[model samples]
Target chain A: MKQDVVIRTVCRLIVPFIQIFALYVIIHGASGTGGGFQGGVIFASAIILIGIAFGLPDALQRISEKTNTLLSCTGLYIYAGIGILCIIFGGNFLGYSFIPLPLDSAATRGLMAEIVEIGIGITVMAVMTSIFYDIAVKEDM
Target chain B: MIWEFNFALFLFLILCAIAAITVRNLLSAVVILSVYSLIMAVLWAEMNAVDVSFTEAAVGAGITTLLFIATLSRTTRRSED
Candidate 1:
């Protein structure tokens, strides 16, 4: 479990940047190529990198099982809530423009899409991290 | 898409794939599989499938490799078969 000081230092320095970039990818996904899935994976990778460099116990302490489970569900609700809202507004499911937003049709659609992407990103990040934790954590430990 | 670059990448890709399957060490195979994923990501980007390329790079090369390594920790490093 002993890690080099150099590895720990590098991981500490790089994790924040990785997280910021993940946010950027999620937010910009509406207009660009990267989306919720990619952003979420990137975020999870950052945590995984920390786990690898530090230790599983440290990483789990940072993001506990309860927090992870809550996050995954919260993301799904955000995504489905939007879709159901559209239906309640007399449009088909996920009909973003149907929501009674003050903005114009295209703008409303864009905004809804962004929210959905964020939700997706959150769910993905939590799930992927949890998957890593499950696979990596030792039974005896 | 330059033919020469594509050809070189494909060559490397094939080699990586072969090595990944044939390598006796599970860790080496996992590393080689990661290399294969990276080359495939580049190929996807070259073909204008940037989204797919990004996914390949993130999930395929990044998370999958880490998961494989994590699994390796619980088991033997060498493959008996």
Candidate 2:
């Protein structure tokens, strides 16, 4: 695919802003309307925009299959690990207050929720990008 | 909720939905579907469902349209029936 200067330039200019907004959505999810899933989808859309403007090879180089797989796994681990940590602390699964934190119970729960949101954001971003790559790439036999 | 705005949006929504299904060109269909999604997002927001509106804007209009376009590129552009 021939790269157009207009599309490429616009994509480069906007990708950063898109990613930042996605992070904002994820971080503000506890108190606001957006959440991890929405943020992750937005982030993935940025990568997809890059792919559309710069070609699949360039996008893949930026985020290779191996890295994508690793990220998805790591996000899931973070989510489950926190849940198990709460269990070990004699609280129900994902009971954020049970974790031995220096902060008050409400603060601890809030912090844990934030971490969970981050985990979810990471997983969704990686998985969505992976899905796009799988669908977009042509199989050369 | 403004009834006039809601009525106009619903009219456009129906038109887009019909156009999306009836259009023979797959690309046009995808685009119309994206437009439909955009209008739906506005309606969701008008109804005070901001979260759903955001999701519709992002996933429905943005990612889903791109995916459909990608799929169209991989297949034929015109529909047989």
Candidate 3:
């Protein structure tokens, strides 16, 4: 598939832009038409595009299974860790207003929300990509 | 709301849905399903559910298509019925 010059060139030209757009969606979730789930899926789609265009081996090399597994765990931990932090700060779990950031409560809550969104995006992306990998990988039966 | 455009999209959505179910070829049915997802995304966008629309476009049209194709490669391309 990589030998196909047109597909290779087109994918190369577009993948970076797609990733950037996905990041934009993730970060701009607070103010615009995106959120963790949408952004994460978009990002995973870019990788899936690469996997389709190039091949599974090439894609797995870019993101090894071990790293993907770790990332999935890390993303979930970040979300749960934030909730725990909120509790330790004398608030209910996930109650961002009580987060002791050096800002007004509302502003701090907004920041925490963004952080949680990022964490969710990471987990979603990792899990989606991992599922694709598991399903798409060819077995030597 | 642009009632005319929404009606047109709904029409296309219904057509695609029927085609997807009735098509004998599994691969063609998958393609039709992707089209259905596309129309649904546009409908969501028209209704101002931009987030849902974005999700539909990405997951439904993109990743879901790939997954279907992958599964197709592992199985028969023709439907029994």
Best by DockQ: 1
User: What tens-digit string does per-residue lDDT give for candidate 1 at B1-81?
Assistant: 799999999999999999999989999999999999999999999999999999999999999999999999999999987
lDDT of 3: 0.88
Ranked by lDDT from best down, the candidates are 1, 2, 3
Per-residue lDDT of model 2, residues B18-81, tens digit only? 9988889889999999999999999999989999999999999999999989888899999988
Off by over 4 Å in 3: A1-3
Better of 1 and 3 by TM-score: 1
lDDT of 3 by residue, A10-109 (tens): 9989999999999999998877889888889989988888887888888888988898899889889989999999999899999999877789988998
Model 1: per-residue Cα lDDT at residue A68 = 98
Q: Looking at candidate 2, what is the lDDT of residue B39?
A: 100
Q: How far off is residue A84 in model 1, in Å?
A: 0.2
Could you give me the TM-score of model 3 versus the true structure? 0.95
Off by over 4 Å in 2: A139-141
How is the predicted docking of candidate 1 categorized under the CAPRI scheme? Answer: high
